[model samples]
Target: MKQIINTKFAKNIFLSALALFSTVTIMAQEEDTSSKFSLSGSIDAYYRTTFKDGGDATTATPTSFANQTGFALGMANLIGTYEMGKTGVVVDLVFGPRGTEATFNNDILNGVINQAYAYWNVSDKTTLTVGRFNTWVGYEVIAPAANFNYSVSYLFSNGPFSHLGAKADFALSDDVSLMLAITNPWDTNDISASGTYAVGGQLGVYGQFLNAYYDGGGQGGLGFEIDYTGGFDISEDFFFGINAAYNSNSETDSGFYGAAIYPQFTTSESFAIGLRGEYFAATQDGFDDVPVTALTLTGSFTKENLILKPEIRLDSFGSDNEPFLNSNGEATNSLSSFALAAIYSF
Candidate 1:
């Protein structure tokens, strides 16, 4: 009986060793594959206080114009990526303080698809991406959650936001890259139906002068890009681009907006400074005959996880639409105000 029990115990030990070996082999195989495929992303959250003369539905309070404050609380965003060989898949999801505003809302939807794309290399110099994606336009961008420049450009979000279609990237050299995209112009994140469908494309070139890595850790770099996007029924108004950008509708019966932005500066490894100055116009000739041209200046400072931005924006809604909030949280007409905010990202 003792000999029989020893045999059984040996058999169990052998089986356990075999199982462990198989598990280790499988894990090693997975690791080998992952060495070829990489995945990464980030998340941003913040708390804020607001002071105002009670303006806009974006904030609903009138505590004190000089010291009105409330919670600017919300989780900014999250993103994920999967890469294999020359192909990659990336998805970005954003959640904002507003919860989720509308299906029409583009980047900040609670669980919506901000970017779900499959990208592949067509050649050493060219690559292609398909599925819902962002246009290769705009100075400020919606770069996942890992980017420090979190606040968006008015033209970034409010301009022509997103695209659902195809885009190609070509490397001109070590210093330059060009992109072209053709997209469904029903605008973005749109669920409603409109009779006419708009189709559009963008051409962009991105570049930088020089760079350095800090074993000591600091931050400063120089870069710029030009993008043009406009394909419809319009003249004297092609989305011409300089650090430049432009937009014009396809018809005269409807009004459109256009701008040329040449924003650039310098940054230290630990912090930096930059500016965005742009000119804009909106005209819808019949019931409203107004056009506006304005400029905005913004400055920011950053140290590790803390970021503070003091900005002054000037806009002329061409006598048609501006910023205003009534007692019942409603808008009356065109009015404008000034505001400042500080943000921290971790």
Candidate 2:
């Protein structure tokens, strides 16, 4: 019967994601038992083998990797954190199934708290937070030591992940920094969230640009961001600079985004390497007969906790378009896909 109501709606969204991790830390009353809580996440399981150059196998897009072969790929998170003193609470959830968790696979469970916010230090350049945050406008990172561009880019994970509501952080010194948010934009986590395409309110700014001396490392920081999304039927605005990006919409009357400045020279450390080259295109999404073009090249290998990634990609939108899978499953429509990744982190 519709798979028993989709397994009771995935067990009631996993018990409302465990009641949003204990309803505001037990309705806030305070207890500090030596202040300590630590749990972290990262693991994008890999093992893919597919080479479907077939003419037509059910005409692709069953989440297409074409003619779909075996040795699948899934699992993109591992998290948890809790700290005492200055108050702390975090519940990072990600369960992407491929091997276990009652098979029918894709072990879904991401964010009841991908990031749970709570911070306060009311002085020396203020700080405050409410719940669910993270959006510096993207160099590249959903959170993985602020990525240098490693499989998750197409305007930084399709632009927007975690921007719940209520935020404040300003440290206009020691290299200037200021953040402001009054969000609702993303998935909003049920509570009767309505008026959909997404735009309940969002605002942000992060500055760092001054002192220039080349060779990829020497006072290198320049960024600009702008976003005013309110799309339930279309009303979106976007901008980002330090590379380039621009957007406008009711389904794209414009689209220009950029990334192709390979860098990975972080100092005071052991070893690091980040190289990237990317391009994404769309102009006239109001539909002049649909068009989309994509290309990517990525690499990252860090020493510390260990991280390794390698990728290459390409895509085309029409002519019955089929090809685009690079998180190591390797597939490209115009032609290309090869990936190798390994991550061991704490």
Clashes of each: 6, 6
1-346 per-residue lDDT for model 2 (tens digits):
0011133443454345445434544444254345676777766544323233532122222221112233334345556666654446566554444212211222123322455666554456866565665554544445443454434545554444445444556676665555554444333433313322122222332342221100101011111223321112111221122333443332224433444344344333444444444454444544333234445454556677776666554445555444555344545454434455555666
lDDT of 1 by residue, 1-346 (tens): 0011133343354346445544554554555554244344333343233223453334422111111233343345445776654556787655553223312444334446667776765469977676676545554445323222333433444344455555667777775766655333434443212212223334333432111100110010101123443222223322222333333332333333345443434345544443444444434443334444444454556667655554444444444554445445565333233334454544
**Residue pairs in steric clash, candidate 1?**
51-68, 218-269, 219-268, 219-269, 219-270, 233-250
Off by over 4 Å in 1: 1-69, 97-111, 143-154, 175-178, 188-246, 260-269, 286-290, 293-295, 318-346
Instruction: Tell me, by TM-score, which candidate is best.
Output: 1
Give the alpha-carbon lDDT of every model: 0.41, 0.42
TM-score of each: 0.58, 0.30
- Alpha carbon lDDT at 171, candidate 1: 79
Quality of model 1 by C-alpha lDDT? 0.41
